[model samples]
Target: MLLPTRPCGPLLAAVLPCLASPLAAQSTDPGNSEPEPAGPTIVVTGALESRSLQSLDTPGLGLAVDADQIAAVNAINTEDVIRYAPGLVVRKRYIGDANATLSLRNMHTTQTPRALVSVDGFVIANFLGASFDTAPKWGVLAPGDIARAEIVYGPSSARYSGHALGGVLRLETEPVSRTAVSLGAQSFFQSYRYYETDEDLFGYALDARADLALGSGGISFAWRHFENEGQPQQWRTVAPGTPYAAQATIDDALGFPLRIAAQDSVVDAREDQFRLRANQELGGDWELRALAALLLDRDGTSEPKSFLTDGDGQPTFVGIAGVTLGRSRSAELLAGLGLKGHLGDWSLDLAVSRFETLDDRSRQSDPADLATGLIPQGGIVTDENARWTTIELTVERAIGPHRLALGASYAGYAGRSRTAPVSDWRTAAPGPVRNASGGKSELIGLFVEDAISLTPALEATLGLRYERWRAADGFLQNAGARVDYRGRTDAAWSPKVALAWRVSDTSELSASLAWATRFPTIGELYQASLIAYGPNVGEIDLGGFDPDLAPERGFDMQVTARQRLGTIDLTLSGYRQNVRDTLFGQTILVAGPGEVPVSQSLITNIGAVETWGVDFIVAAEDVVIEGLSFDGNISWIDARIEGNPLNPALEGNRFPRVPEWRANASLRYAVSDAFELAASVRHQSTPERNLENSASSRCDTFFCVSSFAFVDLKASVDFGPFALDLGVDNLLGERAFVFHPYPGRTFVAGLRWTGGRP
Candidate 1:
């Protein structure tokens, strides 16, 4: 995603004073007796919510990308929002699409995100684990539809299983009102003027929902579609007997000698989701809710590989013939029921859900093959399906000033994949050739959390969790034998402790320590593939299963401070983490007579490592102008591997992808009763690339990605029953390259029509 553009002289000068100002006197609006609850400070992806960021007792760091600010970042998808978060990194290899990857703390290589992603509390990730380039495509979801996104960076292994090793992210959709139908349409223009190429994108969405009263129960239903023809990127290629930059751009004004591979790349994403839920109070002490949801997300793209390139310092163009990377399809379904009630002094909550997913892959050798079958091709490369059923039960009881909660959960996953029959594009053969075995994994967990007030100014929290995980073998042998390579089952216990002290009504201090664990994934143990690029072809063999492999464990400690001085609010935090039995991917060499062949790396239990960091945030409301405000946060972090066979000096090395510093600021002003304006800026420093492999030249020195800064502008107008939003993304079109070279100078304008009876 694109970073905000650099701010102008005036905007930069106004940030400090705006953030340092005292809170404005409680507004004395003519119609209201009290201010609107100070605009509702929300705390998400954290436990034990506090009034301000610093006093938050959560053990891990938390970030919330406001919808307004998200628009300013000019991100095409969700990952764009956290691309600059303290310890977060986002990488897109060839337009990620559905397979883009996001990492936290530079752990992108081995650790499955440790980060969990959920849309409305429903988990979403490449079931194979978080590292398979399965991050949700941002182009599918509209920025205008997002209410807010919360990112928690760190291993929260206790609360979640599967891919939540690095941290967790929760994206909340805008809530639907009782009865309303909203419609909106938007479009934008983008181009690299120097390249003599231009593109235009347009889309529209419709949302309708209503709550009906059935006796004493409530029922609601809601639906959304999003589409765009994205701008193409520059391309560079190295061919046989040619230098890396054999053919560079003639003028190379940008200095990155590369040719525009495509005049245009098209992106089409459509999602049709429906949710129906009925909530009812059963008798006086029992309540029940039943919900059913069907979500179908279809994304397709046409990428013309190396269609244009440089030939001897001049531009050479290729045909739009058949050359596409990924032309795939995916679908998911979820349905569930929940029950909550109270008996005496105890409260109870229970829920059950079923989830399913299907992915389809296809390709054609020649453009004419689509109609003439020039190469006789017929078969699906791979198909994956996942079925999950989960049940969770929780009970909470209050004794005096103490609250205790107990919970138990069981989850089962069944996933299977197979290749459809196919023959060479020209030859003729039918029926499936290679069928991959499917597998299943199951987990059961029990947890308890308690909050107690030791004194008027002090509070404490204690939490514990016990979990067991198991997976069955699902691999096929080269000799046509079904391989039973399932690994062993394991169990672990995790715990967390926190203390909060209220030094005064306006300030507080808190500290917490937590221990967590994560199990290895099926793909890590049995992935097999063969990849080909031009004349180079190689086999990828995921190492054999290691039943003796231990679960990765982590210990984290954090301290935080929060205070409010008049109109200004500030937060500061420091943290340290120790990880053990870290599962790292290690490349091993196999002896070959005349050539060197690289196979799948082994997933071994690496020694250990430590990470330390600090976070800072300051915000103010109503600076010089009544409706103007500003907020920002800065971060500093250090992560390293203690000692390993690869490098002993790596102990204190900085984490590869964890940038040394990152921060953001925004200024929003209400121009008139029906109009408002906003501008924002975000910046990030470069980060080390790799820390584990030292023998290679890749890590000789910490190579930093150039620093980038960007700005955005938006205006909103409310005209009675309808509202209009006009905005510009990356106003300066700086091409900052936060994670990748995102779109430059895009424009967006939308109109929303809303009407209802209160």
Candidate 2:
């Protein structure tokens, strides 16, 4: 849960030249050659995998960061690794937010399924749905467990599936090396002040890890515990039926005057993570790797506060539609196994994984129930069975001038949930089912790619991926009335091309183009949305899902240039992508005369959109001074809707949540090998609330995204067997919003001690 706030340098993170140069590898290290290795290992330095661990060899622009850099970041969650990266944003509401959403370029924050996120080659991004409720499982990772993180932008790699349309991210964990044991702890405090609310929030984490020497290899076990309290996620306004407050009223996001009522929730969370990994070299260059992880989440909102006062200056909560004062707990498990080695003339790779939620249940109670103190009251929602499984087989061989690679992948998902009125909210016996749903989704993919050496200066790659997708066992129940949905299947072909030119020893150029098809997620295909997220938090009734909705299909293209100037590295990249049949949530109205012109919200194929962007990255060591180094990048994107017949008024409007300009930079000075000082700055322009680029974008108000600039500083000191960390985020104490108010200014301090290895 630690990462540098600075942008990962172009050299460490993006647009790097191919590894080993495909042309050179084809001739020098063909899989056809056999190597003899009969060595016994006591400590597993690492596994010898046929495939390269670095994914930056992919056609598109990519970025990377290592453990040394991660240790410098003042972060509390794994997702914060990319918070300040170029063309990236982690919609993290607070220090311990479980719904931290990640946005890649044009994908925006709410489109969670568009990105392919993996850890140690195991898929962690949730394809269950594209929203906060189904965010990637970052909490499953033990804090301080990652060694490196890399990301490839766009869907130009045939080795990956359409989820790469947004981007592909991979987190590499530390390999078990020698027998070692370590323990670490960190604590953080944030001072926050906003409209009608002010307070201080604090959190901390404890981590322990052990690496043991096993028979012929090594195994590692890690555990982490975290607890935190966050500010209220939202504030209510504009409700009738009563109590007037003493505080002054304020204008809302749309300039509407209203009194701030009770807050949504001030979350209190406790989480625990346990993970185990084992690696063994099976002789003959073959290796086996295995992983098992578990995560438990306990969150609740026990205190409900209402700003409004009754007739005698007493607090009242009668006007609110819902006031939750209950807790939710869930347990999740993830397991993976992989094998890679030589198979005759080809190098073969196999991977399999399963992620499941063993128990997921929530208890919610209306505030009125607290007054009555009934023995049995409130409601219980259960999602007892939800899981995903993935399997992959890949092989590669160098034949003549072509390096041929082929792979097949399968991913399956299933989920079921029920909501019922209970006797007791905490340990309830269900009375009658109020709402329920069950469904399944799956994808089967086959891909082939060939890297050819056109000449010494030129290299080309051609690739294609074919996918078959299906959805079944869909059902929705309301008040015991069940409705079943028909099953559906789809097939699509994605094609990709990439070219790289070694201009000279000082420079290089590359370009890539691809076509990808992204199918609908399970929730988007079956569930009817009741509460809206983002800026449009007002009450809405989205009636039903379109089971036959068209899949998102698009063309992505990019060009890049890189140059080395002494100790400095510079990279410029540009990209353009257009997605048709874009699956979006919007409103349409078609009321007849004499009927009320009410907008009907729907999640459907919302026509088409085109996006264009440019990024400039600069990384330099020993700038003007010997100890000074800098890493920075700037991005500009213009994403707009092309047309939408159903909501034509939105034509030519900016895409929601995509900022027009954003930049990240970090400067560091090493006083010595044991001491370092670093400073980082993050900035982003205000974004639109909806597809129409609504005029109601309030920059510094509740429920709105605002242009923000934050400065952070960190100082670290290392002793032989111990380390000390001191950092402050948002040094300027600037105010901003990402639907929920962003943290004001936070101070962090940590201490770690290690001793077993030396």
Candidate 3:
């Protein structure tokens, strides 16, 4: 599974040709071909320039946000491009957050691997592992470089891999149209307040990009520098004898006062990212694309502050947390190459990509006295390496009312992590591994899809996909003991069907049903943590990982109705998803002959979940005025665990972080030729943090999601090639939480210059 680096042409050539045998007729677009004598025309909304989305033929077509729409929002990072897209949300805690996770519908953020994110048809989402630490590589993109962003709903098309359970996020960069350079700068700040803490967190971003218009193609290079200081992500429960004054403490989810302590994830971070892309046309309706990106980050987590004082009323609180806390450095790389050709009535696409974690070293040291901080002591450094590669091929052709497509793809992952102690965490090196866990995974897929115009105003499409997945080269080590597990494989087939009808000139109704499977990642398969029982005590040893953990299987269905009325559009959608064999692992005491029992994690397939939701949207342009527009949406979702034999307490509890209600509204108006004003409002209901939905659900502390609403306002002024903007988020100072406190009353300002010679 450890395939060669990116641009692996020979490997791609050897693998992608599997679909060549079915090279026949399908068109990627319905607008490109003219309708027949009395055929009904189906107008798709938000279809971008080139149909890069494989699920275009599926019902409940995706939503799109263009440069103009993006300009109306106050975005902090690249993922913010789709922040307000219908049914989509990014768990971005603050500015410059690298671990921002994207959630879809009723799917919680914990299912990170189920969401597939791509840029220019190449996979950029981190598949090495499935957690917030392995979130999508959004840092590789600069916000100013994006031209359009779209989100396709569900895994209803054969054009996608199994990772498309939640959905797909697609982004495209601006085409290099001129030899020009652009510079952008933005600054933001927030007033944050919580128990025992009240302060301001701030950040800034700077970016520059240059594009070259080649004779027959184009090339572009971009660089971004960001620095930010965020509020503490965690706090220590304040009890008697803690560093802080217990009497002055405040309550949290766990029902206790809390104080900032060492290793609180109070991050002060800086990042530098660079990217280059080139696109060239090769006559005969063929084009080639290449992309390269690099990201570097240095994070500092300093000692926490204390409010305790001595007899003299001077600061005196000084203590050490039980965990190591210090600095970390990381670097990653992404590279991709793709070729597309238009062969008369058919189209062919081939691409290869690799996302590699080149170097990641985390150093942690024991905290010293606050006055004489950071004494050198025996510390630990965790080193990690990971990467994944993808190669894909697709052929599409259309003949009369029948359109068909065939696709083949291969994806592989390789990752390793080890931790050992060093003499000095700051600089010293050389140590033997005390613990380690690693493995490899691979998936190969082939699929076929056919869509036919069943009647004058009705269409039907059927798609089926076959996938083979395997994991090998897995090992977990503890102390001097080691265990190796390998050669585990599984296969599954996903089928999809969709029907759409154009009821009238201004209305359309559609329904879709799909079955999808999500395979366990290398991390999930390895289990990765080992515990031991003493042999001298006459106790048998229990293995660390459960190699037989089954894959997660799910069925998804949706129905949608869209109607256009005068200058307004109304849409209503309903969806349901059921999943089995959910990966819910737990550890408990196992009886042994000796006095001490053993506790080890058992990775098992032990749960079933069900989710259902409905959403309504309203949009309009020129509402009573020539330059006024409004867009609003509201949704309700229900997600709960159906059965859990091992933990029956959760048999009917709500899923973690799945809110029941959500809504968003935006209004834009043109004040003058050079000025525009836009405002937005967003809201969500409280989300439970625990599987059983018990004690933590009623609190709005560290482990809670608050039911809150906030407003945002932005004003932009443009003059020739220069633009200036000012905006405010949480305009009403709304207080909320999603584990970490959401920023409050934040103000943002930016300036950009685009019309300049390179």
Candidate 4:
């Protein structure tokens, strides 16, 4: 099925000012300016000015990164540009790894649904699945095309959904002010050493952008192609003293018959992206914008361990013990249209968007070892597709001393997932279809907000949002048996209040209280159950779909203070959040129909959890020297599971993957307008054990990861229309790990060219 396309002609026509009305209103005020008093005005400026207003009026903590700052970072991945933001972390394992997601204060890295990521108000999060594997498509926007990025903390605004429980990241693309063109290229290399494997790999990207003017409108286009080869990171583990190891013949190079070692693993990935945007200023306070984007990605992984042979010259390794190869290809598209205008005393903004994964196909082959080499075995193949459509309409006006705003939103999603076994790569003969699932979801939200000026130096804000969510058309199949699931529907009401007091000309204090609810994704409600095989524990059955799963609700409060003295600026904030019905996946032992013991992993609603944290930031420019500056932020968080009904022993356990302390600092020195150098450091404390807080947490064994810090240096020089940048990351060669060891010191260099006027 194809997604529906919308037309904006009628919307634009309706908002355009009439000829007679403009003449009557303008003429009457032309000669009366001397006597007319100032009244409330609706400010409808460009995107940059609009963002400034949003940052100031929002009732929460926020941070902004402009173009100059983004350029100074010289980041390869777009996510890397925000790495220094307070209380935010990007779980990017490597330069080209696709399974990256954002982690915020009190939120675990694996919780992909806790935060919202968007480009120009259009969501890029992959709602197809709920796991970390379904992170937002950050590739849609290249780093060179970003004009600014805004990060808002907490769920204190009526404009967003419960997905903002952790926070929101909004990326705004640069608009074409005049004819402009740019071309950029980057190359990076990393040397990795883990266990017995040591190797060097490299990656590169090519980007180009152009903007043109058309009559009263402008159009812009950007393209980027990236490719990379990554080193082996996964280590295969086998018991040394086991019976199987005793029988296995040892390879001369490997000292032991069976041991934990890095296999010959390698990954190669490629991506291509293109984006086009057009904007026009309709006469009389009306403007229209449209955008279209497409992305294509292909990735392949290969693992071929040392060959081992037994008697009769027959290779013994097979199945899970042999060579493995996997490949996946995917494509995504995003399109949207927006209109903003004024109608008398009311200002309105309307937007409609559609995002779709057109093709998602993957193939995997595990061959058995033979005398000739590796023999092909029947492989597994899967395909998935997802689509989302959203519509938003908002209106704002000033009534007396209060600014009132109201909005309505609708979002819908549909997805399909299927898996099958293939006999051969050439014939592609399918044997039996195994797991299959599909579902659809709908959401509707209405919200209102009022910002009132109670006094000359004090202000108050109140907001309320009502949301209705429904999941339907869900079905799952396993072992040739299919089941139709019942549909679920729910509604929630969220409220927020905030106050801001201007203590002095350069200082202010603010506080906010809010309550929000987050709903479950389609995958969490409809995926099929399966039995997984483990080397140490044999087989474990993982239960899927608990239709009765409840939503998570959070109550949050925060206070913030901002002050500036001379050339130094400081910000301090403290916050606390309490949550009910926290959802978590746990393993439990159950009895099958045959009285056999089975370990099942299922998602359940835990009782309660609480988190508290503090953040401090300081920035100074030209403090004591001519062109020297410093910027830094430090955060400390404490999160614990307060209660659990099913597992009483876990009453007080720290949250998994959340560090106690995290900090970032950077110092920059500018020799002149054309050259600059910077040094940065990042540190994080050790995290808790696992979610269950089992005895396994207290170990320095293979599964344990420790605290670590990293330092980086960057330098850039600009001449005429050309610029060159150099950087060295992980300068100390720290081998850090968050389940997987990070790369060693890496070197990067880039050249860029820019032309045309602003």
Give TM-scores for every candidate, taking all chains together and pairing residue i with residue i. Answer: 0.78, 0.89, 0.89, 0.87
Q: Write the per-residue lDDT of candidate 2 for residues 334-410, one digit (tens) a residue.
A: 99998988888888889899999988888876445333222225656555578999998888877766777899999
Clashes of each: 20, 6, 4, 0
The per-model lDDT (C-alpha) reads 0.54, 0.75, 0.73, 0.71
RMSD of each: 8.0, 6.7, 9.2, 10.5
Q: How would the candidate models be sorted by lDDT, starting from the highest?
A: 2, 3, 4, 1
Across 699-757, the per-residue lDDT of candidate 1 in tens digits comes to: 21112234556577778889987878787766887654423345567676777776554
- As a whole number from 0 to 100, the lDDT of residue 418 in candidate 3 is 88
What is the number of residue pairs that collide in model 2?
Answer: 6
lDDT per residue, candidate 3, 1-758, as tens digits? 01112221232233322211110011234523322323233333322222223234444456666676678888878987776676767787777778888888876775778888988878987776666677888987887767888777778676777788888788887656578888999999887776656667889999888889887788999898998887767655333564444434555446654444332545787899999988988887788998899999988776555445555665433443333457888999999999988777777889899998888998987545444333457787899998989998988877787777889999999999888878888888938887788889999999998778888878887899999999999888765777888588899999989887766545556788999988988767775544355553322132545766788888989876655555565556788988888765555455545656666555566578898998776666678898887777788989999977766767788887788888988888988878999999888888877676877565665657777788999999999998999999889988777777777788999999986553
What's the C-alpha lDDT at position 284 in model 2? Answer: 85
Q: What is the Cα root-mean-square deviation between model 3 and the actual structure?
A: 9.2
Model 3 / residue 35 / CA error / Å: 10
Best lDDT among the predictions, by candidate number: 2
